[model samples]
Target: MKEKLARNINIYRKEKGLTQEELAQILGVSFQAVSKWENAQTMPDIALLPQLSRTLEVSIDKLLGYASQDRPITIYEEAYLTQDYYWGTEPNQACYQVLQRMPPTKPIKLLDIGCGEGKDAVFFARNGYEVTAFDVSDAGIEKTKRLADQIGVHVNVFKADILDYRLDQQFDVIFSSGVLHYIKPEFRQEIFDNYKQFTNPNGIHFLNVFVNKPFIAPPPEKEPNAYKWHSGELLAHYQDWFIQESSEIVFDCNSSGIPHKHAMTSLIAQKMTSLDH
Candidate 1:
């Protein structure tokens, strides 16, 4: 939460054209104090939260890194409330790629982004990887925890929005499936940069994004914020990274009880600082 607060303060302050000194002056605190907050070294006083929120033009909840208590952002919330898992109890096939490549021979920290129902997150945990997972839905988080408990493995799962959640710790493997479209195009670079920065050296990221295709029609779910990626768009952002594998495929889906086809681009990228690995 401290990391979220710091990131939000910096982002909102910049959006409002305020520097550290200016924001400090408005909050009646030292510029050093404002800098400290943005650096995640310290936090603002509780009394100043309202004022800070007002000045930033964002709610206190947002400043503290909480998604707004507004309407449901994800349709799966209701579906997940059912007795069965919405997506299914099976881990994605991409999970096997990570397991085979990294093998968890040593302690490997893995993060399952948008871990719907905990299938993949629990899979990683059961494979001896320290796993953390998050999704935007409360029901999904509950299901994730329940699945992990039923499997006798622990997954540190919580609720998080991909747009607002920033990693404060490093991970060896970062995996996400069918969630990158939630990120607006303009914010993609910044978000990916943060993810890359927080990754350990030689860390791997396996991600798949729904791509816009001339032949393939859109899915049944009309999520409000989803923006389909252009073919190879995900790779353009990782030109500097070692692209271990990449492929584009068209697959059938029965989500929402409506059969449809989706074109997706999947990439396995590795971070490297030097040629000698």
Candidate 2:
């Protein structure tokens, strides 16, 4: 993992306004030890994990680079955390709000990146849309398939990295909620470029992602949260293929039930009828 553990730890520490020297003193370690840990040359021993976590003001799971949950639920916190309440309470309503608004005269073929737990997939498939779902986690893909089978719905599930995955088929709509924000900013433009190729004529794309608005704060940290985004920064990335249809930014909770009183932005854009890929 290229020693992301250390990198994550450093991110948390800096966010907490603690320097290596300061944190070292608190942990009863030399500044050099803290530096090595930050540099990924070494790791804190398991015995000191609890102390380290408390001193860092992060949960042990966060200190260890795992999800906040007791069990390592998903590799990424946003994956399941974003979906739990939405799925448990009003999954179909959530999907319908996005999908039904489209002009229904045409058949809809949909592609979902990071389709965790198949909540949205089930909603779409049951409503007679052809859906192709992708997730990087095998466990997620298995759960999607099982859910589809259980509901007597048909869906094609692919367990693959979204960054490397490509499709020969195009779709009338490509909807990825809580997935686009997870993409690192540098690669975001390239990722959107790929989406352009995936969209059929007159197709629409929907996205729900984090927005940077310091005035609207996020929930208390339970772990090393690696990414932050401003809505303006993220929208600039999609200007080429997405013309804003409808968008709203609101206070929302993150996947872990953390109070994310930040601007959660959602947009619906119709793909330009003609764009030479």
Candidate 3:
């Protein structure tokens, strides 16, 4: 908790474009105090939490690494509120890959990050994997629950911002699609490290990101939070892991009722142990 709080403080402070001294001034604390809090050497007094939360524009629970019951933070929340699933009920092709490569011969644990409307997560759960999924949109989480309940499968779905959420438990497989771009380039290392650290050895991560290309125009759904990855940039983080499949593709889209194209890169990597030869 201390570590998460410290990291969140630093992240939010930077995101607000404030230096240590600047934030300290706003909170009426010495710059060293803020630094110590961010370094995990000290924690702010309980009384200061409210003020700190307001200043950072974050909820107190979030500052302490808990998922606050705040309203949805996703641009697709409106679309998801409708009865129809915004992204549809069909699971991504990567879901099939995970099923084949790491079938739940045992009670395999899997995580679906940013599982918009729960289709992929539900698919995994129905196929016998123990699945936990989360997204930043309340509607999305609710839709996921509805899907699982309707299918008679269980999926532990909740609302969480991918940028602030960290894995605290080990999982056998981690899956994400069309969501990595929500993480800014600067915070990718720390977030990815957390993901990799909490993954059991031999765990698999099937992730895809929209890559910025000169030829392909951006999609019609111009999301403010979206940050396109550089071509081959996603592969750099998995140098130590075995890359089973790494490729890029140009795809068509009509999400916003306007035709456009997007380039995306996908990677399927498996964690390796030092003993693996």
Task: Score every model by TM-score.
Answer: 0.85, 0.62, 0.92
lDDT of 2 by residue, 78-118 (tens): 45444333344236344775556674455678887778777
- On residues 35-154, what C-alpha lDDT tens digit does candidate 1 reach at each position? 999999999999999999999998898788887556577878788999898788988999999999888999999999999889999999999999999999888999999998999999
Residue 109 Cα positional deviation in candidate 1, in Å, after optimal superposition: 0.9
Candidate 2 versus the native: TM-score? 0.62
RMSD of each: 3.2, 9.9, 2.2
TM-score of 3: 0.92
Q: On a 0 to 100 scale, what is the lDDT of residue 156 in model 3?
A: 90
TM-score of the candidate numbered 1?
A: 0.85
Worst 10 residues of 3 by lDDT: 66-75
Descending-TM-score candidate ranking:
3, 1, 2
Residue ranges of candidate 1 with Cα displaced over 4 Å: 1-3, 10-58, 275-277
Candidate rank order under lDDT: 3, 1, 2
